[model samples]
Target chain A: MSEVLVIVPVYNEAASVLRSTLEGLRPLNHDILLVDDGSSDPVPELVSDLATTVVRHTLNLGQGAALQTGMEYARREGYRFAVHFDADGQHPPEAVDALLDEMQRGEADVVFGSRFIRADNRALIPSFRRGILILGKVFNGLSTGVWMTDAHIGLRAMNRRAIQCINLRENRMAYATELLWQLRHHGLSWKEIPVAVVYTAYSRRKGQSSWNALRIATDILLRLIYR
Target chain B: MTPIQLLLFAALGAIALIYLKLVRYQLGAVVLLGLVLLTGCIAVYAPDLTTLVANRLGVERGTDLLLYTTVIFLCGIFAVVYGRFRKIEEEHTVLFREISLLQEQVRRGGAAT
Candidate 1:
């Protein structure tokens, strides 16, 4: 098994989509761990023969919970590094090399895949989504005090120290902010790498709606008061 | 007692009973319930006395004072309940994560890693 674990959190995705995602990652030769967040479609079962381990959640916890499970698995299994990859195929598998390469430089403990890092990648994001992402970036910067080019990108690589320190409490969409907050709280170094996001009809349907931005802000406020 | 006073008494009694049952083990809640029950009884039976007290506190009427205090009290209760629910959810997540991790280990025949 490779020392780096590619952690993919799968919800109710199609088997074909998941299969193609796995096929794309096959060339990277990393140990893949699929955190099945109580998906109804059984996509992970279809790709069981792909040399990946599947951890199933009996109930549908949110994406934040699924990612936390993947991180915990990586820590427990003694993986040296872990990459957060999307199961919906939006995040290009080839970008995993960029994340791993940036990670291997030993300068930053975490390397985030950012579309806003390069002008070409920025042009690919839909205009509507780009507006929301800009708002999110500002809001997250004010809240977490750590600004980023992208606020909620799932493509990220974390070293062992980051894997051990980052404990996600938000079980829903607010986790993106929480992760950034933890970066500052733990004093972990981080960098942003240019990456492309493939916006297909399937991914767009599964993506966050505009209304979710309000909910995420509310969640962050409640968490701040509760904490 | 007037019809309204009787109705209010019944409502207060029900609330006190429910609180008593729920907070039997909590000393702070028991004390709070006692104070609220006392205030509720005074508001129901001795309107003039509460109005007298309200006047001392610069309030218009006893019922108005009760309304303002009740609103504030309900807001506090809502916050407490919401915080409790969030705590329960965090515990549930931890339990679910442990179960998922253990299940994966079992599937791998309890092999390390």
Candidate 2:
């Protein structure tokens, strides 16, 4: 078994996009687990021949729930490390190697992929998203008490302890903040490494909107009250 | 004795019955629902008493007081439902995760370890 498991959380993504993503990671030889978040499409049959494990939600849970399912699978299956790779084809497959390399160093239990750490990466992000992310950084810092250069980046990697300790309660966009909060609460060591994000028109269209930030903030507040 | 009062009392009685059945195991909920039912009976028969109470509470009118309380009650219900909805969502997620994991194990022809 490969030491690292790549956990891809896919929703209603097109078959073509998912194919490209799986194809990119095929050469890496890492075990891949795709948590299909109750897609109405024929995702299972479409990727039936791929050498990856698919755990499917019978109902539509959000991305956070999907990732949590992946983590649980990894913990049970005895993977030493897990990478959160998007099936939307925005995350770089090569970055998986970067993340695993950093994770194996034993310095940090979790490594976050940051698109703003380098100049070229910073330029690639659309300005509106940049503004939202800056605001999100401050918002997350105030709420989660952990701050980083990026907020809500889909690409992240973590080791076994981090995987075992992190339990995500927020089932939607708010999980990004909740993950940071868990990092602090669990006292898991973390570092941010620059990774390239390819913002194709497809990803840009499918990505979070500026208005959704407000909804995410509201979710965090509600969790505080209800929890 | 009036038409509206008669209608309200009938409605309140039905609601009280349902509440009693639903919350029989929850002592606190039973007490709260009983108080609400008592208030509903008083408001149905003696509307002026609420106006007097509303005056003591510094509200101008009993109808306005009822409106405010109704709004507050709805907001409380909304919060409770939201919290419970989140809990139910979590439970569903667990069920889905377990089913998916078990299904995978079954497909692999290996018993879950």
Candidate 3:
């Protein structure tokens, strides 16, 4: 069992960016789980020989389900640390190591990578995106009572306990907030890291619309009502 | 209660039951069945009750109240079906991913390594 397993949930990502992203993780050489979320593209074929295991979804379930699949696979395969990375080239591959190191220090059960956590990364993030993240922060605070600087960032590393406790139900973008709620509800220890993301034009194109904050909020509200 | 109203209630309830069953969405079937019964009762014995409730709720007419309630009820049912479908999809994804991992291992000569 590897000490750390990286879970990258990808769907129909461009070949060029994925190749670069996979290559970027070569230095850490962590066991990679690339969850192909029912991609139309030949994602599995492209990553077949990338020193990684490809988990295929027959139907497109969405990023949350893909991440859950990857996390469950990591848990089953006996990984001490499991990381959540985006398929798009937004997240920094090496920051995964930083998150795992923080987990190993025994300070936190879960580590979240936040671009707003550091001054330099904050400076790099554009104003338009920061406003959306702040809206997410406010929503998280009001809905889940979990206050954070950034809420939508996918960069995360969790240990076995966190994996066992933080069960995600949301199948899409809303799962990010659901993960935060679960962590807060379970009273699990968590730390934040100042990780920077590339935010390339392609990644930006793939990003969720800021208006989607309404849909995410409604999903959370309904879950709360139905619960 | 008119014979016409009773027939309409029965017909609509039957349609709802059939439609729900056809879809095989059973999560809230019992609740839906209960709603049907309540709707039957309203149609048969207390159709004017809608008017009273509408007055209390500051709505204009009995039909308007029924329409509002029906829309809200449908939305609730929609939410339930949506949630159930999501749960089923997640479970399938989990199973699918597990099988993929197994197949991959076997392809690589598996535990024999």
Candidate 4:
């Protein structure tokens, strides 16, 4: 039995695309937790037969909430570690080992996959998109007073200690910044692993927009003031 | 009434109609209506209300008081909207957990059966 779990938070992704990504990860030898964030489509139905646990939210609570639900389930299931995998066909399935390796190093409790730190893949990150990521990092730093490369990247590996110690409450895009805040609040050790994202035609069409970067900043700023 | 006065009333009437139709909460609708009337009075009788409010509050200008009050009101609205969203989110999370737990129970029960 795989001690590690992969959490894929998806919202309204096409079944074909989601299926292909799940299929690619079959070799990872880890349990999969598919959190369907109140998808209006038949997303859960499409992956019902896969060797994965499908969790559904009755209401659309956004990506952060989905990840929290998945990770919580993983921790409760007695998994040693959990990786935040995107349902979109962006992250390479083979990179799971590199991320899992970092967790096994016993040096850091959390490992974040940073695309900016690795450029080996033929990933085509648009200039404007890269600028938005930098702005997101700046916003995150301003919020939590901690800075890290690829603050907005979705792929991450967290050991049981990290998951058990951190509490995720952000319900939307603000969860990214909230994760960094939790890392600081719990004094958890972390490392950034160089993982090359596979930029595909579908990914370029679907993904967080630049507008969302500003909104994430706004959300985090509001939380800092009111929270 | 003058043509400008008639046009102003028409615009205000249209806004009130839309507000009544769109607002879901009764308390919210009442508060919004009160604000609309307050703004109308401020715009039309600024000198009188401003003078009275400024004298009572010890403010130099009514515009400054209005600006400050507007900022405070906007922040209050932001807090209310954000709090309501958080409340709904938490409740939904509870519901999700209940359903997931039930699903797990049913699976285990089926396996036992």
Scored by lDDT, the top model is: 1
In the range A38-74, model 2's lDDT, one tens digit per residue, is 9998478889988788888888889998999999999
TM-score of chain A of each: 0.97, 0.98, 0.95, 0.95
Q: Model 2: residues >4 Å from true position, as ranges? A: B110-113
> By the TM-score metric, which is better: model 1 or model 4?
1
Give the alpha carbon lDDT tens digit for every residue of A1-227 in model 1: 78999999999888888899999998999999999999886645788688889999988999999999999999998999999999888988999988999889998999999989888999999998899899999999999999999978999999999999999999998999999989999999999988999999989998878779999999999999998
State TM-scores per candidate: 0.94, 0.95, 0.82, 0.78
- Please provide, for model 1 over B2-113, each residue's C-alpha lDDT reduced to its tens digit, 9 standing for 90 to 100: 9999999999989888878887759898888888788888878888888888889999898788788889999998999999999999999999999999988887986554
Q: Interface-residue RMSD per candidate? A: 0.4, 0.9, 2.2, 2.2
* Highest-scoring model, DockQ: 1
Per-residue lDDT of B1-113 in model 2, one digit per residue for the tens? 99999999999999888878877758898889879998989999999999999999999999999999999999999988888898998888888889988988787776334
How good is the docking of model 1, by CAPRI class? Answer: high
Error of 2 at A8 (Å): 0.7
**TM-scores of chain B, in order:** 0.82, 0.91, 0.67, 0.64
Write one digit per residue (lDDT tens) for candidate 4, span B48-105.
6765787699888777777787799889888898888867867777677658646755
With candidate 2 superimposed using the best TM-score fit, by how many Å does residue B7's alpha carbon deviate from the native?
1.8
Report the lDDT of model 4 for residue A199: 68
Clashes of 1: 0
Model 3, B1-113: lDDT tens digits are: 57888788778778777877775877686676767677656755776787888889999898898888789989988988987886786677667767767766776686367
